[model samples]
Target: MIELEGLTKRYGEKVAVNHLTFTVRPGVVTGFLGPNGAGKSTTMRMLLGLDHPTAGDVRIDGRHYEQIRHPLKYIGALLDAKAMHGGRSAFNHLLCLAQSNGIPKSRVAEVLDTVGLTAVARKKAKGFSLGMGQRLGIAGALLGDPQILMFDEPVNGLDPEGIHWIRNLMKGLAAQGRTVFVSSHLMSEMALTADHLVVIGQGRLLADTSMADFIRENSRSYVRLRSPQQERLRDVLGQAGVPAVEAGSGILEVDGARSELIGELAAEHHLVLHELSPQQASLEEAFMQLTAESVEYHAHSDTGPPDTNGWAGGTGTEAVSGGGWGEQWAREQRKRKAGG
Candidate 1:
């Protein structure tokens, strides 16, 4: 288990991590998520003692990492895949680490096989591709066979097959009662792999909860309806105290209203229903919504506003524009104050 108590890090005048406190228990895969510059990497660095925290403490299995005797035997981490010496062969790299940590050389081949890098164990790491480099990193982390593993963006730059492999490996490790904590920007992948989520924004804790609870709390459920008499339907829904927004021509998105009620309303109004479907916000959307202002970077399309044109036809788009609970609440408040 890993526990962080009021962990904080600051660089000059800017605070990178602010009094962050959380516990990662064993036998579960916990996902760490945040936007760029939200201090995720900083927090991970502090945990591994790569960077010193200005305040607070981090404990691994009831002991600080710096205080642990033979620390590799209890905790393992993959901070950077490219941190290895490029000239060293895969086998040599693992051998050096094992030797320094008092690990037997036999375990080197074992970990190489585990990461499926045995074929290229003799090859120089400089010749490895991005995916291969990641595998090598994972092998090094597993060399100690530690009970606690932390991987930061493990699936970045990986192909679909490699991504799936990493996902399964994390789950398998957690199944064996190991504490598996990974950080990633891919919410879709996290949704499939993580049982718990720890979200942060602007160096502050936004949420720490189970995956199901986080989704249920942050996501908004609504029904999209399209009818010939769109204005009439809007008026009817408004009169019924149902919040709605006109979503382009002949389409309306109704919130806090059930599909059954929508059907009954349509029937009573004799409206020509062209389309009606329920929509649930995705994890990616919730993440964006929660950290909109905390996003250090924003990508703008060349054409214009994103909603103007369906470049690839709605199939490739993500739900909720990175605005999570905080943004959603702020938007609601603004609307209410404006008499929306």
Candidate 2:
């Protein structure tokens, strides 16, 4: 299990990560989501001991990451798929990690086969494609057969088949009571893979809840009705004290009413209905609804051509600059260099 208590990170005047506190328990895939510049990458860096937090604490299995003798055996992470020596072969890469962490050399081949990269194990890292690099990174993460795994944008360069494989792989690991924490911007894939969600915005925690509850609470749910007898249906719903708004194309949408209830009402009124379906908001819609204000970048639609500022039909500071999040990182790096 991974636990964070009052975790915070600050670089000069900017708060990269606020006091975030959440528990990523075993036996389920907990998805991490946030808008651009929301401090997601910073938080992950701190969790893996890649960066020091300015305040608070984080632990893996009741111990700090630095204190663990063999961290790979306890918690494995894939923060950056391309973070490897380009000249090294995939097999050598995994072998080196295994050697340092006291993992068996034979386990290298097992993970290579597990990620379907056995054929390319002898190839140099620079020669591999993005998807192949992703598989190699995953193989390294599984080298120690750790109980907890964390992946960030694992499907960034994967094809459909690779995506499906990784999705099921994470589920299979969690089924064995392993803790799986993943961060991704692909809401559709996340909706399919994650059982729970941890959302943050502008370095602050916005939500930590089950997937179903998060969507239901943040989005509108309604029943869509389509009928040939539109007028009769509207009258029936009105008389029954259920408000329905017309949605063109001979369709009516009723809020706070179940499909079964509406179907029974139509039946009692002797009305002919063509469609009666419950419409729940999708995960993407729910995410937008919750983080609308927290969005750091904005794109505007206009009839004119794009402006020199790179933002379409807009000018001034309000326009989204190219250096959105990178500006913050550049400042942080400069501060570090000066302090050093």
TM-score of each prediction: 0.81, 0.84
lDDT of 2 by residue, 265-333 (tens): 999989988899999867876776565433233213212222222211122332232333233444446
Residue 121 of model 2, lDDT score? 88
Estimate every model's Cα lDDT from 0 to 1. Answer: 0.82, 0.83
Model 2 pairs whose backbones collide: none
Assess the local accuracy of residue 113 in candidate 2 as a C-alpha lDDT between 0 and 100. Answer: 99
Misplaced by over 4 Å in model 2 are 293-340
lDDT of 2 at 339: 100
Candidate 1 weakest lDDT stretch, 10 residues? 304-313
The Cα error of candidate 1 at residue 225, in Å, is 2.3
Write the residue-wise lDDT of candidate 1 on 49-88 in tens digits: 8899999999888887788777777888988899899999
Pairs clashing in candidate 1? Answer: 288-322, 288-323, 289-322, 289-323, 289-324, 290-323, 290-324
Error of 1 at 148 (Å): 0.6
Give the best candidate by lDDT.
2
